[model samples]
Target: MDGQVNRVPDGGFGWVIVAAVAIINMTNQSILSVFGQLFGGELRRMNEDTFTAALITNLNSLALNFSGLFIGPAIKSFKPRNVAICGCLFVSLGLLICSMATESWHFIVGYSFFVGFGLGLISPSTFMAINSYFSSKRGRAVGVSLAGAGVGQVFMPHVVRYFLDNYDFQIAVLAMAMVSLTGIFGAMFLKPLNPPLQHNNRKHIRLLSEKDVEKCQVTPQAETVHQPSEESFSKKMLSRLVQALDLELLKDFVFWSIIVGMALVYTATINFTMIFPSFLRHSVDLNSQLVATCMSVVAFADIICRLLLPCLTDYLRIPYRVVFLLGTLGLFVARMFLAETKDLRVIIAMSVLTGMMKSATVINNNLTISSHCRSEKLAGGLGLSMMSKGLIVITVGQLLGWIRDYFDSYVICLYAQSVILFLVVIVWSPEIYYRYRRQKRTTTKSIETTIEAGVEEVAKLNA
Candidate 1:
C-alpha cells in the first residue's frame, strides 16, 4: 500500500488474490502443523522409531527456512507469480510422492525436503508480490494476504482429520497434493507491480554488435547498448537488496524498538497458534473438525480487525506504536486468563481475543515497517523483518514446547510469555516519544527556514 498499485482494487477480482494466497499459505503451513499429526501414525505403520519421524518434520522446517534465502532472489529475478506457480508444482508433486512413500527415508527425502523446498519459494513471493496493489491500505492488504495462513490453520487439521477418519493417511496426502496443484493455477493470476528486471547480458552484447555493423562503424549509440559488465551487475544486485530493505532505517530509533518488540511478539504468537489445537483437544474432548471451525471463527475475527484497524488508525491519527501496545496487552491478558481457566467457554473466549490481539500487532507492525522503508527497499525490508521473526519463532517455539513438557501443563509457559510481553513494552516505551520529538524538531526547522526565505525575498523586492 505504501508503494504501487495492483490493477483492479479489492472490490473486484482482487478477492482472488486473497483466495490464492490463502491456498498457498494453508498448504505451506500445513507442511509442519498438520503433518505433525501424521508423524506418529506413519512411523507406526512403517514400524519406524519416533526419532526418524521427528527427523522428517525437522527437515521440513529447515528446508522451509534456508531455501528462502535463494528462492526470494528467484522471485525478484523472474516474477513472483511464475515462481509461485513452479513452487506449487513441486509441492503438489512432493505430496503425491509422499502418499506412496513406504519407508521413513521416503518421507525424509520426499515430503520433508522437496515439498518444503517448494513452499519456501512460493510463500514469501506471494506475500511481497501482493503488496504492490495497496500502498495506503497495506495493513489491510497484508492482513488479507496473511489471513490465508489463518484460513489454512482453520481448515488443514479438519481436512487431515477427515482423511484420517474416512480414508487412510495416504489419501489425505493426495488431497493435499491436489490442493497445492490448484494453488499453481491461482498463482498464475498474480500480477507483480514491478516489471521483472531483465538480465540478458549476452543478448545485449549481440545487439550492440549488430548496431555497430548496421552503421558501418562503431558509434556512441552502439556503445550505449553494450551489456553492463559483471561487476556492474553485482553492484546493481547489492544496491537493489539494500534499497529493498531500506537500510536507512537503521539510523532511526523507532525501527530498532519495533524489531525487538516484533520478535517478542513472534515468540508468543507462534507457540499459541501451533499449540492451541492440541491443548484444546486434550482438555476439552473436541474433535479436529470442531477445532478447525473454532479456529476459522478466530480467523474471521482477525480479518475484521485487519480491515477495521487501518481505517480507524487513519481517522484517529493515533500512533501505530500505541496500537502495538494495546494489541500486545490484549494478548497478555488473553494468555493469562486462558491459563487460569479450564472451562471451554473461557478457552473459546481467549481464542477470540487472542485472534484480534495478534491481528492488531501484525497490522501495526507492518504499517510501521512500511513507514521506515523507502520506496525501493520495501520488499527487502519486509523480507528481512519476516526472516527475523521466522528465526525467532523456530527457536522460541521449540523452547516453549520443552518448557510445557517439563511443567506437564501449558499454564506456566503462558505466564512466562505474558511477562516477556510486559518487559518488551516497558523497554520500548521511549520509541513513541522518540518519534514525537523528531517530528517537532523537523516542523520547527521548516518554519524557521520559511521565515528566513520570506525576509530574503522582501529584501530583494525593496532593493
Candidate 2:
C-alpha cells in the first residue's frame, strides 16, 4: 500500500482512490452541471414559472453544496468509504424518488435535499482521501479526477436529451438513478489514510511517521493533564462538533479570498448552465440542432481543458491563484463578446471558449482550496468553500431567473455575469499585489542574511 502516516502515499493505492473519486464525481457533479438542460422539462412537467423552475435547480445546487457544511464532520468521524457509500445510497434514492415527482416540493425534497446532500458528502470525503495520496503531482491528479465529471458533461447531456426526446422526463430521471448506483462500486475502492493520534501535551494531532509509530514522545504528566480537560463530555462533544465543521476556517483571510473570488466565477458559470440552453433555443431563436451542437462543443472543449490545463500549470510552475485569475479574465472576455455577438457561429465559438475557461477554473478550484490548507483542515476548508458556493448559487440563481423573466435577454445575463467577474478581478488585484510584495520582501531579507553571514565569515578568517 506504501502507506505513510504523515506523508502522502504519492502512488500505489492513491491512484485507485483518485480513480474512485473520479467516478464518484462523474456521476454526481455531471448531473449538477447539466440541470440547465433538465430545467425546461422540469418546468413543463411541474407546470411552473421560470423563477420556480430556476429555484428547483438552485435548491438542488444549494443542497448539494450546502451539505458540504456537514461532510467535513461526517468524514472526520466516519471513514471516507463509509461516508461515500451512504452518499451513493442517498443519491440513488433521491433520483428514484425524483422520477416520480408530481410537485415542486417533490423535486425540492428528492433532488435538492437527498441528491444534493449525497453529492456534498461524496466530494469532500473523496477529495480528502485523494489528497492524502499525492503531494507533488497533486495538481495533475486533481485535474484528472475532476475531468471525469467533465467527460460525463460531454456525453450525459446528449444522452439525457435523447431520452427526453424519445421517451419522457421520468425515463430520463430513472435512467440517471440507475447510473447513480454505479458510484457505490467506486466507493468501495476508496481507502482511508492512517488515522492521526493526539499529542499528549498540547493536544496537537500527529500521524505516525515512517517507523509506524508516533515519532514525538509524550510525557505521562502532560497526558494526565489533558485527560482531565476531557472530563466534560458535553463540552468535548460540542468542541468536537465545531472542530469537525471547521467553523474556524471562516476566520482565515486566504480561505475567504479563495471562496469569494471563486464564487464570482461560479456564479457566472452556474448561471450559464441554468439559462444558456433556453436562451439559445428561444431568446436567440436558434434551431435545436445548432443549440445542441454548440452545447456539445462547449462540453467537449471543457473536457479537454480540464484534462490539459492543470498539467500545463504544473509544467509552467504557475501559481493556482494566478491561473484562476487568468481564467476569470478569459471568461469575462468571452461573456462580453457573447453580449455583443448575434452571429450564430461567433456564439458557438465563444461557447466552446467559455467552456474552456470555466473548466480551467473548475479544475483549479480544488487545487486552489487545498494548496494553502493543512492536511487535517482540508476537508473543512473544502466544505466551507462548497457552503459559500451553495449560498452564492441560491442568491444569484433567483436573480438570473428573474432577469430572464423580466427582460427575456440572455445578453443582459451575460453582461451581468461579466460585471461580477470584473469585480472579482478588481477585488483580487490588491491581494495579488500584496502577495508579490511579501514574497519580494522575504527574498530580499534572505539574500541580506546570506550576505551578512559571508561578511562575518571573512572577518573571522581575517582576524
Candidate 3:
C-alpha cells in the first residue's frame, strides 16, 4: 500500500468517485436543507415552542457533527466504502423511525441521533475518497460534488411538499427514507485507493522520490526489536488512536482560526436555512407553495454559484481564505437586508444573493483546511472541524431560537445570524491581511538575497 500513495490518477476514475460522492451529498443535504420545513411547522402546530423546534433541529446537527470525533478513527480503521454503506443504512432507518414518531423525543432519537451520526459517517468518508483520487483539480471536483446538494435543494422541497399536499406527513418521511437508500449504491462505488494515502508532515500530496521511498522501507530486524508487553501494546494502541484523530492539528494557529471562523459562519448560515421556512410561513405569511418556490429559487441560485464560482476561483488563482472572507461578509450584509425587508421580491433577491455567498463559503470550508493540513490528515482535520462546528451550533443554535421566542420575531434571529457572520469577517480579515503582508516581506527578502549573490558572483568574475 505504501508504494501507491504518491500516484494519484488526478482524473479518470476520480471523476467517477466525484459523481458517487455527489449522489451521497445530494441525498444527505436535501433532507437537511428542508428539515425545518418538514417538521418545524408540525412541531409548532402541536404547540411546541420555537425553542423545542430548534432543539430538535439542532440536535440532528449536533449529533451529525459531534460524531466526527469517532468518525475519523472509524474511517481509518475500516474501508470508506463500508463506512459509507453503514451510514446509508443508519440514515434510512432513522428516516423510517421518524416516519413512525408520535412524540418530539422520537424525532430527536430517530433523526437527531441516528440520521445525524449516519451523515457524520458518510461525509468524511466521501470527502476522503474524493481527496484520495484527485490532487490538482480538487477544487473543481469538490465543487461538482457539492453541486449535487444544490440540485437536491432545487427539487427536494417541492417533492416533500407534494407528498405533504397529497399524502400524510408520515408518508412523505417514508418516501424520504426510500430515497436515502439510493445512497448505498453510490457508497458501493467508493473503491479503496490502492496503497491508500498516508499522513506526512507536508501539507500537499507530493510524489515520494525513490530515495524517500527507500528510507520509508522497513527492515525485518528493526520490526523484531519492538517486543510488545501488555503496557507497550496499550501505549501503541493509544498512539495509533491519537495519530488517527490527528489531535496535533489543534496546535496550529491557522487551522484553529479556520475551524472557529467556519464553525461560526456555518452555524449562522445553516440555522438560518433550517429556520427560514418557518419564518416565511409564520412571519411573512407566505403559503406552502410560495415557500417551496423560494427554497427552489435559493437552490437554483446555489447550483449556479456552486458550479461556476469554484472553477472561476481556481482559474483566477484566488486564495481560498480571501474568497471565504468575501463570502462571509456578503452573507452578513444579505442577512441584514433580509431582516429589514418583508417584500417578496426583495426577499427573493436577497435569497439569491445569500445562496451565492453560501456557495462560496461552503466551497472553501474544507479547502481552507486542505491547504493547511497534510493530505493524509485531511480526514482528521475535517472531522475536528465538524466537531467544532457541531459544538457551536448546539449552543448558539438554541440561543437563536430563544431570541426568536423571547422577542416574538424571526427578524431578530436574522439579525442575530448577521451578527455572527460579521464576527467571522472580523476574525478572518485581519488574519488574511497579516498573512499577505508576511508573505510579501518574505518574497522581498528572498529577492534581495538573490540580487546580492548575483552581484558578488559578477564582481568575482570581473576581478
Q: Residue 388 in candidate 3 has what lDDT?
A: 96
lDDT of 1 by residue, 56-129 (tens): 76567667655645553465556678778888887888888888888878887777888877877776677656
Candidates ranked by lDDT: 3, 2, 1
lDDT of 1: 0.69
lDDT tens readout by residue for model 2, 318-412: 87778888889889998888778678988988998888888778877877877767766777788888888888877775676578668877878
Global CA lDDT computed for model 3: 0.82
lDDT of 3 by residue, 343-453 (tens): 999889988988899999988887787777776677788899999999888788768767977999888899999889898888888889998999999999999999999
All candidates: CA RMSD (Å): 6.6, 6.9, 7.1
Which segments of candidate 1 are over 4 A away from where they belong?
Answer: 1-19, 26-33, 36-40, 47-59, 156-158, 161-166, 197-260, 277-300, 307-311, 314-325, 342-345, 362-368, 444-463
10 residues in a row with least lDDT, candidate 2: 199-208
For every model shown, what is its TM-score relative to the native structure? 0.74, 0.84, 0.82
**Top lDDT model:** 3
Report clashes for each candidate as comma-separated counts: 7, 1, 1
Assess each prediction's global lDDT (C-alpha) against the native. 0.69, 0.77, 0.82
